[model samples]
Target: MSMATYIGLNFSVKLNEDYTEDEVEIDYVFSSEEDRNVVKQKHFTTPYIYEVFEKDEPIWRMNEDQKIHSPHNYEKSKKTFLYLCHLLKELLPKGDYCEVYICWLGEEVEECEGELKFNLNNLQIEAIDIYEKYFIRIEN
Candidate 1:
């Protein structure tokens, strides 16, 4: 099975000196199949995965989250969700809270469900299509 994901960044933008507005990408697309095709067919194009490093070690990364597939493909990493957050702290100032929202399509997210605390209304159940997605909200 081909697992696809939609990685979205949600935050607010300053509209004016007196006003700040929330923004979300309804049209932003991050398809894995499309990315794979690009990698296979396009040699000159830049790779999509980007990361920042400190002292030759990465602070954060968005590439494949350590996948080991079948007999040929094998990959692993020491990174975990908590470790990722710890790394993010080096980039973000103190006292900022980040929230991650994950809700899969084809299932009713039934308002405030999961091991982690998150707003159910923010789930936006009807917006999912074409891929199994994961949304991580990085707030500063």
Candidate 2:
């Protein structure tokens, strides 16, 4: 069976000064799928903000947090969540706060929620409260 997990990043952008909008992408028709598929397919893309170290172990690996999966997969899931935390830290502004919400809703695991607050001032993860329908394995 395939594993699926939802990964999302939410933050705000505040401009210091007003500026006019630049050129936008004009709507165009594509003759074929290949013609429209200009962007490369990737697990996730964050230009200069963050980079994925391991191609085999993307953040989506956290989907293995199910009872059907082996302990090894679970271990990888744990590690991926750490990477997610680091990614969130890197994406947040120095003085801004971002809410991190990751969920693993597998058959056996049901729904596992990880909520956190990134403390930009100290470069530390301040609040971490994870709730799981099954037994929790990932550490804070």
Which structure among the candidates has the greatest TM-score?
Answer: 2
C-alpha TM-scores of all predictions = 0.27, 0.31
In order, the Cα lDDT scores of the candidates are 0.28, 0.32
61-130 per-residue lDDT for model 2 (tens digits): 3443442465575455456556555644565555543322222222322333333333433433212323
- Which RMSD does model 2 reach against the true structure? 13.5
Best by lDDT: 2
Local accuracy of candidate 1 as per-residue lDDT tens digits, 1-140? 22222222223222233322312211213334444343223221222221111121221222233222321221111233334444444433444434332222222122323222222224332221111223334433
Runs of candidate 2 exceeding 4 Å displacement = 1-69, 100-140
What are the candidates' C-alpha RMSDs?
Answer: 15.2, 13.5
Off by over 4 Å in 1: 1-78, 105-110, 115-140
